[model samples]
Target: MPVHRSGSGTTRRSRLAALGTLLAALSLLLTLPGAATAADSPTAAAKKPARGSATMGMGVIAHDGRGGLPGGTLVAQTEGVDVSSHQGNVNWATLWNSGVRWAYTKATEGTYYTNPYFAQQYNGSYNVGMIRGAYHFATPDTTSGATQANYFVDHGGGWSKDGKTLPGVLDIEWNPYGAQCYGKTQAGMVSWIRDFVNTYKARTGRDAVIYTATSWWTTCTGNNAGFGTTNPLWVARYDTTVGTLPAGWGYYTMWQYTSSGPYVGDHNHFNGALDRVQALANG
Candidate 1:
């Protein structure tokens, strides 16, 4: 499970401190022109839509309920939320009105489980002008990584560089089952992750973002640095501070700060400027 419930007792001021750090880092990244945008592949232009004049912004407001930003500025960082079937019939417009600007809806799990609410959640968010993406709950032990990746892609988990569509994410965290590591050895787990990511790239032409915790990664993959250079790390640390990241990652691409946030579900942060978040959507 994510550290969502661990830091409920953390003070709001402490949380603000953490947010300050994130905002500063993101502001610095924004200064470097084209720093956040990755080089496009040969086929990228054909698949990605033309950039629009309006840029999307995901806002994380203070506790005042007035939607005020961290430093009273609008473009510091992007805010988003991730949802699953558990959050049924989301009032996406209401969420947009409440400062959420992007979303990642759960699409599939293993090869059998698919979120029935995926279309509504994913499309609804996009219809309302929110950048949207889909994620797959990986079950590497149940099947081969390539097989699961294909299943995920076939079932609404593929990505298009449509300026507002983010690349798919692989939610590889603790198994609700008894075996947290999915019954695989350290080396086996690394191999499975590589296979899944490779197949996902071939199918979607975008690197699949990885969502996990440091402790889980260390225990399961022996702190493997294999995905560090290629895949973006979406670290889940629900404390007032982000803990030490998994090995080989100098910084996180996204952070799941809290599940019990002001929003409807797990609240996340895109660790860069508004354009950077939109850049990911462009593949």
Candidate 2:
């Protein structure tokens, strides 16, 4: 499950499913009247802070060209632009004041396409964002995973940086324009995913972070031990309310719980604050 354009050309279905699950559960609890107390609320349950936790880092995918909230910093990565040039004008001071902790500049695309200027721009921009970062491709075609990894390493510089990055993310989702990726049988999809993850780890010497939907996880990689145990999961479940994702999978490191936020330029763009992400990362 690699990140792909949704039919609506916005947030991924995995994000929608996560949000749907939370809303459904919250609706059920509300209907029950005495389902849970404030201390036991689902929102509270999903947001309980981790012990000895660090401040949460907010993230924003600055793909579409648009300015968001001036404060509450965003992590914007360009596919082919020199991201460094925009560093000085990125309003980092405002974001820091508003509570932003990290930013992941895009480094590469499909195996053959590299963000030509990421290297020149993101080499050491950590001081601008609380945490600096880099990311790679997550294609549905496992055969291409190795190629994508190699490209990311060769082009994105192997996620090497002076600052601490939230694990390198493999954005697994739907690719509506291409073939039917989600149509693959759960086992087949899991196998493909495992191939990608294993290949990436072998090449990068770093654990790959999986970004996908809960349904994708259950239907595709739920039974695969490789996914269930080896890597961290960055789940996309966009709902009005937040809560723990359904069980059966391993630990999650981030949750993209919404698509409509001031920081998100598009109405359907993906957006999730840092508290949940930090919880997932540190959980």
Candidate 3:
């Protein structure tokens, strides 16, 4: 059985700290213009969309039996081994068949770092799979976030043929480790976010969506007038119906309501209201 770990108490803060360090490193490396050269450019081969020319319309949220909630159309990167290795272990095929149209595989984290499992799965199936696919980086801090994002673009190699990703997401939550970031204040966090987002957008020319829990959103960038409205928000609220989301967050394109779902190999997951996502993207 997979061991389940809860993000409660001191452990949560500790995890955040470790993740912060990882992200900081990633940001630095990706910010470099020639970090990965040809692979890093957006001109690389693009992957085909799963539903032909028809847009599937829904979104997704992924869980690794942990607290990290990455929103997208297809959710990959469960715990244990990479998705391909445990093909028999997790019923991803079933999930795909059951309306899960895309998969965002975990690509990299902090600078000079990549998820070992993600590397395997991405290299093996990202381009060849029928399900439209993209990769996400577990963003740490500014410098690391840039490096990790760059690494993902460089190594993942390719774009969506239709110019739409399976969905590229930036997993932004409170650092579990609670280590004081160089820029931990609200302004600092917002600046860091801007730096990361701007860098990724410049390189990929794609809108890099922001993924955050209610608390993180409210705490980090709520006060910044420019932060909240500039990018598409993928809000994570595990409980309550989507209808009951906080008043100010109606603009959110996707909601990660249930971490536990049938599609994600029986692990906790999230879903997108096809209509809402389309409306937001179109707007």
* Candidate maximizing TM-score: 1
Give the range where candidate 1 is weakest over 10 consecutive residues by summed lDDT: 52-61
* Models ranked on TM-score: 1, 3, 2
Residue-level lDDT of model 3, residues 1-283, one tens digit each, is 2234444546888999999999999888888876775565553224321211111111222221223334554433222111322232344445545555334455554454444455444433334332333435343543555666676577562344442234456666644323323247777677666777776777766667666665555566554546455566655555443333323445555555454555442122324444333333333
Estimated TM-score for each candidate = 0.73, 0.54, 0.55
Model 1 lDDT vs. the true structure?
0.78
Tens digits of lDDT, candidate 2, 42-106 = 66436433221111111122221123322343343111111222233344454445444555555
What local lDDT score does residue 34 receive in model 1, on the 0 to 100 scale? 67
lDDT of each: 0.78, 0.48, 0.47
Give each model's clash number: 1, 15, 33
Residue 98 of model 3, lDDT score = 58
lDDT of 1 at 29: 89
Q: Candidate 3 — which residues are off by over 4 angstroms?
A: 1-90, 119-145, 180-183, 243-250, 263-283
